[model samples]
Target: MLKGPAGALHVDDGGKGGVPVVFVHASCGNTTHWAAQLAHLRKRRRAVALDLRGHGKSTLDGGGPISVEDFAADVDAVVDGLGLQRFVLVGHSLGGAVTTAYAAAHPDRVVGLFLLDPASDGRVIPAEQAAGLMQALSTDAWGAVIAEYWAPMLAPSRPEVRERVLSDLRATSQVGASAGLGSLLTFDPVTALRRYKGPRLTVVTAFNQEPNSYQRLVPELPSMQVDGTGHWVQLDAPDAVNTLLDGFLSSTT
Candidate 1:
């Protein structure tokens, strides 16, 4: 029953009244991707996890050419639909690009932003590299794409975590994954980040998988390292991310 610009936003809401905190997932990820964070933050603050359009249960009206703006608009539509005023934005990878665009578009509405292994304009893979990656995806019939991408984002703590991550990814529809990849490949959030006036925190993974452009673009912005995690830091090291999130949100609030 979540109405938005495109259509309904598939979301999970928790907590009573405090500042609302929204969790935005990376490409190919849905609301379930933020399960760990939602469980941790919802107890203290209003937490909402949204499944981006074309992903999860969200239904879209005439899916058009995908772009970063489209994703940002969906998020804004959800916020407006919920009648939320001030809130914190937590974005991962492709979600970071969307949140950056949204915050820039509505600077006054965003109190803070926590980016987990965000992608950047400067760090985009060379056209050839991207083409190769795309080719790899096309070649894989069974679609082992998730494993290739999720390697760096997991902690060595438990073998069960790997199985869980794979299961969560497989739960998403292939159509949703491909559609999201279309938008992600074209998104560059470096310029968008420059436009955000709110407090920002970028959490880099320990595997050195983060783009070098992020290092250059966010020179002044404070960043922390999450040991033994990949692009999906929340999944690999939820406790550490939660601790960092709690501190950041507390300071900003």
Candidate 2:
């Protein structure tokens, strides 16, 4: 466990040399989400995956609304604790927003940014829809609501993969999950992304490949859409994800 602003944060650090890479799982997810990536990347480079505050084995000590900036602080804690000078940042879903915030604030510290099926824009969630979800999150219907919201995203995933993702979401803290969604409403991905002028790549599923998506919004932003996968692209198609990551790492690092 590494000491973070919130509390003890769990981190899985491995491998030896080459450019270090830090993996941040999606909201309500843990380091296990990156098991395949870590196993594959650690062979040649230092690979580290951390459980964000209020998720996995990490502790959520402070109270009040949690913002993307707050999540970014967790990344800050991990990199500082590990004494990393510059490294690659990989995030999924909510984690993508967090990594973007971090890279924007500390551009010099992040050599490369990789987002996998991430929440790239606030516009993706309509205000009315966000409000309704927020209300449901405050009641017993939170779990059901979350499951419903994630149902379509898991359609292309394998049965076991889909079940495991749902199980993780169910086990997530209601407070944490609610706060995470709240953060998305206020985060400005375009602005944050513009602040970071570095090597970056956005990998998305068919769900986020819409015309108004992140890549479309920022035309110069490098991105790739992987077919036959869902929101958890990393888990649904580990081999493809690994291949893309390898290419990104090779070109950037």
Candidate 3:
């Protein structure tokens, strides 16, 4: 545990070797969310997983509603505390939004980028749906809503994967998730990304794996697809995701 701007943050350090890869988990998620990615990536390079301010081990009681900046601050603390010179930033879902914010603000510190089925443009998540989700959280109905919505979308095939996803979602604090969702609404990756010019790779589910799915992120940041996976592509196809990351990291000459 390290005392960051947001207090003590739970960070999983994979030791030293190659350029470090910092993994960020999605909202309503913890360090465990990146279990597969860190496990595989760490073998080759220093892979680190962190629990955002309000998630997992960093579950501090106060943090003024989660926002991209808040998430970025956590990463800031991690990087500074660890004395990392340069590293690759990997974020999933909401974590990707935070990664974009960080890379935009600190492009020099980042050597590479990977956004895994992340939520970037506002159009990605319907306004009506976002409002409805917040309303559900307001009513203390997160459990029911998670089963009804996310389970089918994220855990369609794998039973064990589904359970862990739900467990993490439920473990997430309602306050943090709701605020983070609102922040996502105001997030503009297009603007943030404009500041950061580095090797880019955007991985998305095979279903929505196309130029249009990423919209502006397409030509700016070359993208790829993970077959037979959902939003939690890392959980469903870690090997495929690992292969993609390895290829991108090694091929970047």
Candidate 4:
């Protein structure tokens, strides 16, 4: 366990040599979300994943509002603790936003960025919609609302994959999940993307492929769409995701 801003953070480090790949899980997710990638990448290069504060084995002592910067700090702490000079950063959903924030702040350290169904278009939600969602998250209907919101994204996933993702989401602390959504409300993905002028690839599920999505925001941004998978594309189609990772790593690093 590595010391994090809030408490101890759980880190899974495997293999050695080559530029390390540090993975950040999605909101309400744990390192297990990257199990497939870690297992595959460890055979060739160092693979690292961490459980952010309030998720998995990590502790969130303060139960207060969390921001993208706060989540990025967790990544920073793990990176420094491991003494990694340069590494590939990968994130999913909310974790993707954290990756963007970190890359924006430390572009020189991040050699490549890989985002899987990342929550990158923070500007899409209007103020009132964000407010309503935040308010709903605080009510007793939070569970129902969350389930409904994510149902469509999990439509293409297998039964077991859907159960695992939902279980992880349900296990997450309400405070952390709520605060995470709150942070995303104001996250400036465009600015962060512009700041990190590094090799980056975004993989989106068919469910999230929209006209004004992250890839569309930046016309030149490299992205791939994986059909027949849910938002958790990595878990739903591990081989495909790993194949893309291999290609990206080879060309970038």
- The lDDT per prediction is 0.76, 0.90, 0.78, 0.88
- The lowest-lDDT stretch of 10 consecutive residues in candidate 4 is 205-214
User: How high a TM-score does candidate 2 get?
Assistant: 0.96
Clashes of each: 2, 0, 0, 0
**Number of clashes found in candidate 2:** 0
Model 2 residue 165 distance off true place after TM-score fit, in angstroms:
0.3
Please identify model 3 stretches exceeding 4 Å from their true place: 123-132, 207-218
Query: Better model by TM-score, 3 or 4?
Result: 4
- Give candidate 2 regions above 4 Å deviation: 123-126
The sequence of per-residue lDDT tens digits that candidate 2 reaches over residues 1-253 is 9999888999999998999999999878999999999999989889999998888899888678888999999999999999999999999999999999999999999999999988857666788987877888999888888888889999989999999998998888888788777888878888888999999999988899776567877788898889998899888889999999999999999
Kindly list the per-residue Cα lDDT of model 4 for residues 123-149, writing each as its tens digit. 678889988999999998786788898
TM-score of each: 0.87, 0.96, 0.89, 0.96
- Candidate 3: 10-residue stretch with minimal lDDT: 207-216
Model 3 compared with the native: what TM-score?
0.89
Model 1 alpha-carbon drift over 4 Å, by segment? 61-64, 120-123, 132-142, 155-157, 208-213
Highest-lDDT candidate: 2
Q: For residues 192-245, could you state the per-residue lDDT of candidate 3 as single tens digits?
A: 777789987888775544443443454667876666776788888788888888
